[model samples]
Target: MTHTTRTNRGLLRGALTLAGLGLTLTGCTGTGDPAHPITLVVRDAALREIGADCAGATPYNYVHAGTELRFLTAEGTLADSHTLSPGVAVAADDRDYGEATRVPSLCRFTVDGSALTAGTTYTLSFGDRKSQDFTYQPGETAEADPVIALPPLGDPTTEDTD
Candidate 1:
C-alpha cells in the first residue's frame, strides 16, 4: 500500500473515534430540560392592609401553620398536595406600624418541582383563600418568587372566596 493511502486511513479512523466520543457524551448528558422548583412566599398582609385593628400581632404568629398547598393541573386534576404544617420553618418579616402597635409575621413555602410538568398551568390554593393560577415554564430563564398573601385566617368572612 502507498504511504498516502495509509495516512488517509489513519485520518478517517481518528475522525470516527472523535465522532463516537461526541455521541457518547451527548447520551450521558440526556435531555437539556431542567427541573424548576417553585418558591412561594406567604405574607400576612391583614395587619399591613387593614391596620392593626383586625386581631393584633399574635394572629400573624405561625401564619402558615396547617396550611394546604394544592397544585392543580390544567385539566383540574390534583398533581400533588403539600401541607405546610411540619414543612419548612415559618419566616417573619415585621413592618413597624407604630410604637403602640404590634408587628405582624410572614411565611414562605417551597414547592417541589419534580411532579410539575413543563408548560402546564396550576392553581396554588392556600387555606380557604382564593387561589393564584400560574403556568410552569422551565427553561434557561429564571422567574421571580411568587407571593401568596395569607390573610388572618381567624375570620372566614375576611377570607377571599373570589
Candidate 2:
C-alpha cells in the first residue's frame, strides 16, 4: 500500500482501540442499586413550645427515585413516618410566618430497607454525643442543618460511659 494509505489505516485502528477502552470503563462504572433510602431528621425547640397545631413542625423528608416518604413530629414525639408516591411534597402547616428560621443542627442518614423490609432499625446515638438544639418558625422551608462532627470511632474519650 502507499505511505498515505498505510498511515490512514493505522490511525483508524488506534481510534477503534480507544473507543473500545472507553466503553469498557463506562460499563464498569454503571449505576448500582441504592444501598439505602435517604433519611432526613430535624429537631426544633419551637415545636415543643407550641401546641398540637404545630406538632408537625419538626419534619423529615425522605426521597428516592419513585418513592417519597415523610416523617413529621407527632404529639410529644420526634418523628411520625409516612410513605408516599413519587413527585409529591408532604408538609405540615398550621400558621404562616413572614420569613424562614434556622434550626441549630439537622442530621441526614441513609437507612437500609423499605417500610415492608424486615430487620431494619433507625439510630442517631453516638458515643459521648450531645444533642444539639435549635429554633424554628412558622412557614419556613425545611432544610438540612450542619452535623456536629465527632472524633474517630476508636477514641476512648469519646466512648459511651453506660
Candidate 3:
C-alpha cells in the first residue's frame, strides 16, 4: 500500500484504541447522585445527631457547618464538598447536579491516568478533622454517618485531672 494509505490506516487504528480506552475509563463503578449526595452525617460523640442547626456548634458552625464535609480522593484530591445542613454536601460533578432531574453522578476519580472505582476509599474532612479513609456503597447510610465532635473547649489539661 502507498505510504499515505498506510498512514491513514495507522491513524484509524490509533483512534479506535483511544475510543476503547475512553469507554473503559468511564465504565467503572461510581458514587451516585449529587442531591442524594453521599452524606457524612455528623453526630456528637454520643451520636446525638448534629444537623446544620446545632446550637453549640457555633464559630465551628460556619466553617464547621458548610465549610466542613470535604470529600477528598484517595490521592487526596478535593473531589467535592457538601454544605447543606448535615454538611458535607457533595453532588456528582455535573452542572445540573442539584436539580430535581439529576443525572447519576458517581463518585469516581482518575488518579495518575487510572480510573478509581466508586467503592474506592475517599477521605472525609470536617474542617481540620479527618476520618479514616473509606469507600462508599450506594444507598448506604452508616458508611456516611460519622460520629464527629470537637474537643471540649478550654478544658483543663492532664494536671487538672483529679
Candidate 4:
C-alpha cells in the first residue's frame, strides 16, 4: 500500500478503537434503577372538570401511601385503548386535553384495583426502580368561560304566522 494510504488506515483504526472503548465504559457506569412505577389517583372534584384548562390543573394526583409496589416493565394499554411504550411518559399531550401542552399531569397509568382505598394516600412504582408519592384530595371546580356564551334566539311564541 502507498505510505499515505497506510497512515490513513492506521488513524482510522485507532479512532474506531477509542470509540468502542468509550461506549464500553459508559455502559458499565450505572445510572441507578431504570424503572420505577408510580400511581396517581384522580380526585372526584378534579374529575368533574377534567376538560377545563386552569393553572395547576392536574388530570390526576399522585397518591403518597408510603408503600412500594412492583414495577411492570411491559408496555400497557392507555385510555385511548391503545398500547404504549414500556417506559414512555404518558403526558397530557398524549390525550384529548383540548390544548397543546407538555404537562405530565396526564400519564398512562394502570389502576391497581387491589390497592385502591377511600381517603388514603398512594404511590406509583415505575419499572421496579423509581417511585413518587403524592397526596390526593378533591380539586376545586373550574368556572365556565363567559366569552363562549351562546347567542340568544327569538322566543318561540313570537314565531311568524305563514
Model 4 C-alpha RMSD to native: 26.5
Kindly list the per-residue Cα lDDT of model 3 for residues 1-162, writing each as its tens digit. 212344444543343333223324444212222323332322222112211122223334433334545668977898766543323221222234343443321111211112224556667666677755655444344223212222212212332323
Compare candidates 2 and 3 on TM-score and give the better one. 3
Instruction: Note each model's CA RMSD in angstroms.
Output: 24.2, 25.4, 22.8, 26.5
Tens-place lDDT per residue, model 2, 1-162, is: 212344444543333333223323333211231232332222222322211112112332222232323322223233323332221111112234435442222221222223322222223222222222222121111112111111111223454434
Best by the lDDT measure = 1
Q: In model 2, what are the clashing residue pairs, if there are any? A: none
Residue 34, candidate 2: C-alpha displacement in angstroms: 4.1
Cα lDDT for residue 82, model 2? Answer: 32
Worst 10 residues of 1 by lDDT: 47-56
lDDT of 1 by residue, 1-162 (tens): 212344444543343333223323332111122244454433432333221112213444433546667878767778877665322212133234566343432233345566777677787665555366766664353333222333311223343334
Best-to-worst ranking by TM-score: 1, 3, 4, 2
Better of 1 and 3 by lDDT: 1
Question: Where is the poorest 10-residue window by lDDT in model 2?
Answer: 144-153
lDDT against the true structure, per candidate, is 0.42, 0.26, 0.35, 0.26
Q: Which candidate is the best by TM-score?
A: 1
lDDT of 4 by residue, 1-162 (tens): 212344444543343333223223333111121121122212112222322232212422222122233322224221111111221122222236566433333211222222333233434343333344332332221111001000112223554423
